[model samples]
Target chain A: MEAQTIVQPEKKKSNQDVIIIKHLNKSFGSNKVLVDFNINLEKDENLVVMGKSGSGKSVLIKCIIGLLEPDSGTIEIFGRNIPDLDRNELDEIRAKVGFLFQGNALYDSMTVRQNLEFPLRRHWMNVNQPEVNKLVQEALDDVGLKHTINMMPAELSGGMRKRIALARTLILKPEIILYDEPTTGLDPGTAKEIIELIVAIQKKYRSSSLIISHDMNCVRLAADRVVMLIDGRCYAEGTYDSLKKSGDPKIKDLIE
Target chain B: MALPVKTTDFLQETGGISVFTGRFFKEAFKPRYEISEFLRQCFVIGYRSLPLIGLTGFIMGLVLTMQLRPSLIEYGVESQLPAMVGIAIVREIGPVITALIFAGKIGSSIGAELGSMKVTEQIDAMEVSGTNPFKYLVVTRVAASTLMLPILVMISDAISLFGSYIGVNINGITSFPLFYTQVFNNLGFSDVLPAFVKSFFFGFAVGIISCYKGFYSNKGTEGVGQSANSSVVISSITIFVIDLIAVQITNVLNLN
Candidate 1:
């Protein structure tokens, strides 16, 4: 297929919109992964993007976070396109965004406290040790993992590791958080607890979140709005209940 | 005619590593350097590799001295053993052997560590936490390796000389002062400087190539293993290539 390229106009700062992805297209060789994909994440919104494996959900999130460069598109955060920003500008934008990976992505060599303290030290260089300790304690307390501060990631159970990862992300006091399969490998009980924790954090922080997940339980529990990704585009967008009630075979196929 | 697939792959990989090295240079000089992380990496890459490097150096020196003893005795040059062994170790064998061992241990570890971090999305998490993953991870590691290798080579050379001293005393008694005096008297500035200078390149090769392999790692757990394996292979090869270049440069400059 011939590729079409279009430059998007710069977006204005919007109090409601935390992130905006417009005409996002990413291809590896001839295999197009995201074609004209668009989405908006509103402030204080828990927006879940759901898709089957290899459906480009992860790519979309990566694009938003500037981890992956889209072939032609604009990912707007704070009125700036992510792909167009310089390192300093991008870093500034990133200070307000947090990301959680499927594998928990804890710094394996570091203790839990160090992991949580990493972002603070990186982003806020002037932060004192006492403040760092307090923030780390608070972040761990948010995830109910404060007791595991001195323990290495290798010693933590999968659930505990996930919690630590969450705490690390939360330590930055981000305005937006992105989660990629946060409960993919956990037991049902653990998954439920993680989903509940995600919900609680969203409410407590009032931060917008973009969660990429396929777990129906996660969708039901954590997503206030759901975007169905299919064939490199957003096939449908609605509240979780509305999408669940749809009679469309594609939607049914997904929920089932 | 189309090139062989392997040749094309090799070319592509070389180009990628060059670009990665270029990026390392660009990010390395930017502000907000990761000082603590760099120091941590130095400790991990330098101090931690000491025991293995020391053991290898000792064995290399002893083996070389013992092997050369018979030849020297036959030539009626047995008394010159200390000078010959010192020159050989300082000029070539010490740097090359220590670098090879470094490639095996540090290269593989850095590759696997960063590769697993990439696959698990920790690197992405770092980026999202307002940190430059390249600066915080790659630049620190590359710089640490580049800086620490020379010190390591110096230490290894000293240890190797001690080993040679011990080997000298094994059958015939050579006073410690006499052995060290002979070693020092025979070694010139040219001999020591080139080898010392080349070690930085060896360390850079190991650092950059391994980080390149790991930073772009894909596929999953299997990819992590491949990154670790190929990092050592490529870094070992690159170390030899750099050594050859250093030798040529030294020769042209009449430094050898």
Candidate 2:
């Protein structure tokens, strides 16, 4: 018998039409949070959302992930309206989109390995133990924390914890990564390191990303396109230099 | 002004019930255990609360012994006072009173911590990271409570009996060995097991409901306080409800 290579068709299909949010609106009782929010992400594009706190930056991404229900709007990921999907369907959507929480919200009880392995076990049943282990190690390597896999989240420094959280996001090979304030409280040097990691991961995985942050340095480092959220809407949309020089008072204040 | 008060009261009541029932199933099997966080919770829920539970149990035993001494004398069965009070403490009063104390001390703290985390978007961070906060936060705390409270109750029961022994000797002449023998003679597997089992449910209820209130809290700073208050209130009510059901079932089995 002649030696032959088996080709995988599913792996070749591109995750191009990733996420689309249209005219989404949300309110808490009478206080409106997101008002007519719209955005579309192409494959492997890094879109950064900049806004003051409470401007619904997190809420908008949450709606995309189907964590929050927008009162009236359509969120279509890969051409499927997400809000219409049931719980199982939403879980499927979530599996493909990795999120790094603002606080690096690592589970405090589990070791770093357990934390990284948790989603893999829950969502990837076909993956056996050895394969899971290899993937986890690889993820840790990518985040430069391969040595700290057994350590608990509490034992890690702020940057190390953030890196572990990133490793966790990579474990599932997600196509879209949403970062919520990836560098909010870290020292300037550590924040810069996180920003570098974000860019490296985006390029390495060729993954589409939507980052919600107020950190201008991070915005400049990681954003291919920046969208400023103000008053429950996209206030300005442009590249970093364009946004910086736009001369709009609010945009200027945010940049300066 | 009147309408807002009515609305607030209505929300408080309905939210309590909704949170209790919703958290019961949600926390039962969620993935991602927060170990260090849970231990910290245990320290708060089990260790720190020990003093309060201990004080109450001791006083309960002493007061019950004193109050019943007169009545037992009236029946000319003053010699049986130790055994009667011991059985009461071991069989029902011990677990119930200790659990009530647990609810007040631990339940409210869980509620407040979770509520503050929720208000601050920490819970949302967990959910967005492909981790189920319900499983991580609620399950571990509830499970810890389920495991810890029974142990706590057992310890409390022993201490209370000791206190009762001292109370008996305050006015009469009963040796320590005789006091314990009388107490144990009236207590069987029937009395001890059912009371102990019911406490697990009480602990589970307290942990789950408190976590649910705190995890889903939305109104900001005031919501944290509301969650803490409701956790204690609802868990206390649930303890009684479970006790009644447990008693009824125990009667049906002729086990008590």
Candidate 3:
């Protein structure tokens, strides 16, 4: 029951690319993190990017969110270059792109319910309170944490915190979700449950995702297509099986 | 490497802070204000600090009055004790002391809170969730400190004056009404207005410095401690610096 074999038939054109990065280049004081990198994320697809530690996986996600500026490249989300957009414009696009951090980045001071409400309050100021409560509950229920809404992030276990963070991301109804190391710190069983939830949410919302992870279980289960990042560039890209079966030592080193 | 390079680096750091301040200005005025969060911060930074500020103010006034009594008695000016202490406390000591206490308490709290958020990626998560963490966290907290410090200082001044009256009574029989009359008789617009005006700046300085330190914190767990420690140190120094400039301006304007 390989997870890659369960992916459905694709239906998309070149114009349906939700995210496209062309010749991306980023450097930090001679530490070149990305160079001559290009990637396209299609609509309604789960694309997992696998890289070793310090291999620029998180940097790529930050560039997409406009948190990091690339030196010489265009990251076009719905055909708008991320680096060229001003802060306000970047904020506008950020509403459409949800990012799940590795650490579950929930606000420590806020309750789970308040965390979910924050996105709605920011983007849809005119929406009334009843509607907000409804949406907040809906997002929480989606992650099976509706009962924990009133709890502070500290009160929740590690896995619950991660789910709460996911619920916060989902509350915005984003068209694309970017996950960074989605299963890094959790127990194996908890990590598998999170992987299942990731897939379930993607199917339920029909949202495309760009997941950056080194966890093989997550990549194997959640990826419709896998991209290998090595030397700050996309070393290979294909279905998990195609790369897993390849003779490239690097790919073998990763998937095997 | 070189002296010029070191100077340039310092300039670059200053420019970065300037840009961050500009961003706060730009984002704070836009629509979708976090009124509730702002109020919450007011409660946290202002209401919660009441006891500490009050305690310090009382002690400051009592000690100053006790120490000044021997010298005043020797000069045959013991009767002017209330007037002198009232003018000194209202005009300078009260606000500056209250702000230093605030920088110690609220400044460190903000720095540590936001620095922890930064290290754990909560700030980035907020940005991705379409929420302006600056508005929700930085602007609200800064605005609260800027607006609340003056109020806190006013309360501290009143409490301090009461403590001074008690201190005066400890040495001799100065009735409450008489003591209050002496205090009010010597106070004028010049004594009160400038101190109130300068308090706003003190609050904003502490708020912004702490936010700046925390927002740009780096490394990991160690960075959180550094942010908190530096925030207090910088904010304390900034309060004194602001007080110096404020005193100079007031003196030149004949507001002393």
Candidate 4:
């Protein structure tokens, strides 16, 4: 199971929190997704929110990124409340935050080079062509996909597409990255490669991460801490090993 | 005393579209414009559509002339054929027909593209990466459509007239100069200006409605097709509605 060496020191007293979600609540009609859920993303570590299907993990990330507004509570990123910020204000904060979608939502019609260049050219309008080329090349190199620069997303394999999508996210050199199931829909081997890449990128950039994943292997390999999401609430919070060792029935059910 | 549930749903839908439109305009005029993306969209939306529009326009003029010839000959006013057909094609038929074709082609493309992007989270990716998806996606598309459709209509009108000239020569001897002279003589500033003005509205209508349908498309894989279908239906209806209003305005202004 490769379990023993996966846990990190729970040094809660020192790390600065990069993201704070307090009393978060969201509902669609009668379907309550998140109810008074709370968690903090500490600086320079991966915080994984572990949940099963339909457990509102995606909704929580969307709320953090201001894609979906929560019914109540505050999502503060770097001290600014996301929902309360104006478009310009939110956009400014977003420049420092990158999000990787679960499905690797790369632009289908665009080439890998163009997809990587999208965020760079979009946020900084005055950037010239040479600079854009450098950034694109570097981002592609980071994901070990430099040869795919001209290839369209459709031409890439699932794993290659995921790498390209990550390259696109990395082009901006964001300080924080939110990953929505970065390893979902991958073969175990491919998933392990993705987890390693995630960890490598996080270390290279020194970026804080809030990841939503159901794969315990992924949580073990990438998460510095794990938050268990059960029935729209934060049921438990600790390192992977701590959660696995818990005597509580719900936490035990998930870990076992 | 209260409005029906369907009525309330209709109002909410209208309000959602209005808000979306307003947000589009607000972001459209802001800084950090995506020039390359805009130009690329123009190439895709405008240039790629030219051949189809030209062929359709040619057929429209030829068939219309052929159909009207029998009636004109019955009244012994067959000599007036070029002028009558020119007016019909220039002032209403060409613009509306080209727009309908554009709606079917470009409108559906935009809807399907954006809808898939929405479902897949590319739009959200853009937002999280500090790019305004509304600005980068919606504004560029709407502006390109607004600008390109008029040019397409003008080209289509010219091609349609050429087709009509060929139709005229099929059964009678008429020089190109004489046929074209007759067309231009009947087409005054009143005819050209109103038609030209309305093409912009039609373009804007198609772009906005398609974007609205696509941008908010939901319910997963099925929604992509629904978005494209609904985009065509709504944009088609909107072009006609805009045409109706433009006609009334032209009448009131004594332009026809």
Going through the candidates in order, their DockQ values are 0.68, 0.35, 0.66, 0.71
Candidate 3 segments whose C-alpha is farther than 4 A from its true place: A1-15, B4-15, B30-32
lDDT of 2 by residue, A1-256 (tens): 1111122112322446688888888998988887777777778888898899999898888888887888999999878898899866777877888988877767775799988988897677588999999999999999999899889988999999999988988889999999989998899999999999999998999999999999989999988777878778766777787777666788888777
Residue-pair clashes per candidate:
0, 4, 0, 0
Q: Candidate 4, which segments miss by more than 4 Å at Cα?
A: A1-14, A125-131, B1-11
Which residue runs of candidate 2 sit more than 4 Å off their true CA positions?
Answer: A1-15, A245-253, B1-11, B22-77, B90-92, B116-122, B129-132, B135-159, B162-205, B218-230, B233-256
Candidate 2 overall lDDT versus native? 0.83
Chain A only TM-scores, each candidate in turn: 0.93, 0.92, 0.94, 0.95
Candidate 3, residue A118: Cα displacement in angstroms equals 0.8
Regions of candidate 1 where Cα sits further than 4 Å from its true position: A1-15
* Evaluation by DockQ, superior candidate among 3 and 4: 4
lDDT (Cα) of model 3: 0.89
Docking class of 2: acceptable
Ranking by DockQ: 4, 1, 3, 2
**Candidate 3 per-residue lDDT over residues B147-256, each given as its tens digit:** 99999999999999999988998978999999999999999999999999999999998999899889988989899999999899988988999999998999899986
Query: How many angstroms is residue A33 displaced in model 4 relative to the true structure, after the best TM-score fit?
Result: 2.3
Q: Superpose all Cα atoms of candidate 1 onto the true structure and report the RMSD in Å to 1 decimal.
A: 4.4
The DockQ assigned to candidate 4 is: 0.71
Residue-level lDDT for B59 in candidate 3: 95
Query: Each candidate's chain B TM-score?
Result: 0.99, 0.87, 0.96, 0.97
